[model samples]
Target: IMEYKRGSTLRRGQWTAFVFLLMIVHQCVGDIRYSITEEIKRGSVVGRFSQDLGIDVKTLSTRRPRIEFEGNTRYCDINQKTGDLIVNERMDREELCGQRPSCALLFDFFLENPLELHRVTLEIQDVNDNFPTFPNEVIKLEISESAIKGERFSIDEALDTDTGVNSVQGYTLSANEHFTLSVHTSADTGKYAEIVLEHELDREKQDELSLILTAYDGGKPQKSGTVVIQVRVLDANDNVPVFTQSIYKVSVPENATLGTAVVTVSASDADEGANGELTYEFSHISIKTKNTFSLDPKSGEIKIKTMIDFEDTSSFELRVKAKDGAGQAASCKVIVDVADINDNAPVILIKSLKSPLPENSPAGTEVALIYVQDRDSESNSKVRCSIEQNTYFKLSPSIKKHISLITAVELDRETQSEYNITLIATDEGYPPLSSFQTITLIVSDVNDNQPVFDEQSYSAYVTENNKPGSSLCYVTARDRDWRQNGTVVYSLLASDVDGDPLKNLFLLDSKTGVINLAGPIDYEEQPIYELRVLAKDGAGLVSYTKVLIDITDVNDNAPVILIKTLTNPIPENVAPRALWPWR
Candidate 1:
């Protein structure tokens, strides 16, 4: 066992010395193998790590071994005291192990008190669940007249190579006279059978007797052995009590109440009165049949003992024996089959469904496919699928137990972007069971709408000598399309007489469509300005609108008279009404 001392990390020199010492010690103790079970659920015990490592429990108590993965992921844990390794997470051979012949996880074992790294391989054993079988179909037993009553005989028992629940667990012998059956339990707890004589026999009347012994195990659908054994009464018994019939087959509803009478089996003796009188008792009963049925100790009647379920166990094979006061007995086989009843609702499975489907899909476009499952017996699992009252979608027949969700009408993303549809599945059972499933369908965006302007034209007024960058007016456009199709951007398309761009005269916010004065306004120069603005969307769709700004006039400018002089560019005139101009 590897010991990991938990404390401050040691220095490089000390670690190197520790490693050297460990290498010397490891050469003496060879590696060990640990066996574990594959497919074991999480939180289950895999193996005792310390025990498999040949470490004593007391030594393991001081140092706890921790299983560490590459990323320090904990898929299993180790018990400090017992050193047992238990699964902490789920493991899949095909996923983690893949197609490799063997899958193994190598982990570093850190021990507290003394630190050490030990490599261990856990071998996961596969589960054994094969059915049991007998090499021979029949066995012959010879009994002589000298054979005494109450004597037991030995016969070959069934053989099963598999282990665990897959191995033979018990035996069942069909009812017969002259011989009673007994099971021999092995040290491993597996069961085999032997034949015993119930009473003395006389050879004159009966020559041969026959019986069936079945060997069964515990597994899905169960596995078992079947064999025929013939006993040569080379001698016979006093007309062994005989049953009214050798075999009886019957059926009962699974809902049959406990203690309800199922079948009455009877046997008679040749001798009269008490000698002819007989009693009944069950033999070679199975675990499944024992819980479900009970037999009358006196009347040879069988009744329900517990709830009957066809799904769990369908039928029972029982042995009923009747013996006279003289000890002469006879037995018969009874097989009671449970009938199925409809009492469960259908289960729904969604196979193909797309979340957030694009809007405006074709009428026949598929939205989803629903599959229905039912547990009831035939004529019951058959189901019909339908969509709730929806104008946009409908359910169409696809295959058995499957229905396709198809669009019935053209969808408009603008009207409704998403839709939740309810699907109902109903079975053909009485008081039919039904189930509902809800799915959401989303409609995606498309560039189909043109930007809209708040108004075709907007009006505003500004005073002469108005400050620059003053808000004059606003123009807005809207589109109903989603995403990039609906967004609107504003731009200037006209300018003032100065031959400058309109953007220079007025600032327009592309997002809000607000227009601000870029330059001062003058009533004397320009009384009014007509601005054409364009709004465009990310989809390249555009719309145009206009803004009219009226500049109010103010009498602030005084009258001026200019006269050109002969020698200079500027001239002064003497008269106020007449002006002299120089070339």
Candidate 2:
């Protein structure tokens, strides 16, 4: 075991230096490989990244080794504390690789500082976590009493997700005198099981035969699955119904109405009376095909029973069986090729939605996740999702069939607090079908705007010697924000007019923004009063304005006449003496 120092031990300055060096030179050093079993517990050590790359623990830590892989799922990570590759998430081999014989996770192991990149491949080994499965629990087989020995009839095969020895190796049949098991292996189809008749089936002695068929995989404590085989023995009726053709092919539009006949299959029997009268039904057809088409027993006409979607299934292979009165039957294949139709409209499904988005959210912030689907074939199923042009929100393409709704610009609750985001999805079909879905998003308010007065400054006149507590004038302010954030309150900011506090002379109503005279005013003393008022919102945002009040003068005093030193009497005496001197 090799011990390596953790990446956390590296100094912050070293990491910064490494990042700076990485920008100068980046190179691929080569590749490394490892083998591990799937479904290991998270945090299980996989391999030493530093040891495998021939780098010292200190160097690895300084470089900050990181793993980069495809897709969103992170299966492994380099432990910073241990310099070891650890399982980040439990992986299922079957789901990761499906039926592929070899499963490997390929990722790039990058180191900063010196800037070296290495390709790391981890081969995941199977652990037989899943058991073999049969398509159904019961399989019904019809056999005629006149059938000869050694005749083989195909049976359903068991499926195992695990490959190689861990897969379904062989099948076993219950001991029976009438039937035996035959296994066949082919490169194209793999292995399949069949029932072989060892002896002729007798309808009188045994009308029904129940047998067990078990399939097992070659593993330690092997896993197995079983299906009950029910063989129904039929009475002797030699003549079998023969179809007009062994294979019939037809094309029907996906938009064809229900009960529209596609084709009529005719079959005839040479036997007379009860043996010649035949009935028709679907045989060995998939559930989807059977549900889409129905067969008329008497007319042998195949008609659409349910709506067919060309996108889900482009074509269907149906086996039609014609059985005579005595249980003799013949089957023919009907291939129905569904024609394309631009009938399905695109559909939008919301995966995640975040409402009450903050007004201060930056551009490109994800608001919602959406998925679009169209149930039509080929070009008709190709869909494009979009929102209104020049909107605050736009649809961004994400993973397949997924779209992200992100803000194109910052939001402001004062401008538009609530948004009805309409998303439209359209297919690429001729005369394309489109559909729309609307998402309502509300913008949450923030303390972004300060209270603003109706006018920058206000002035009101008050008479001199006015009574106390008189309503001088009202100050109105408005805030654009909503709820408590926009609630405005008024106050007279502390200020001095000739060393007198404005609050002592004037009063402000906090809720209504009303200014009133707190005390008596005299124009002879203080002719004009300059007031500064402040408006504040509940969120603590404040604004200020000026208010000037000029007091109007009234006739409050009487005028007094003053006598100058003997001027009035001297004027009258001079006028009389001037007259006497002239005489």
Off by over 4 Å in 2: 1-251, 257-307, 311-315, 319-337, 359-365, 388-393, 406-415, 497-500, 552-583
TM-score: model 2 vs. ground truth: 0.54
Q: What TM-score does each of the candidates earn? A: 0.58, 0.54
Q: Which candidate is the best by lDDT?
A: 2
Regions of model 1 farther than 4 Å from truth: 1-237, 271-285, 311-331, 398-400, 440-450, 481-487, 493-497, 537-541, 556-583
Residue range 415-517, candidate 2, lDDT tens digits: 8989998888878789988899999999999999889899988999989988989998988889998889899988887887778777788899999988888
Q: Candidate 1, residues 46-82: lDDT per residue as tens digits?
A: 7666766667878977765555543336677776667
In terms of lDDT, model 2 sits at 0.77
**Residue-pair clashes per candidate:** 12, 1
> What C-alpha lDDT values do all the predictions have?
0.67, 0.77
Best by TM-score: 1
TM-score of 1: 0.58
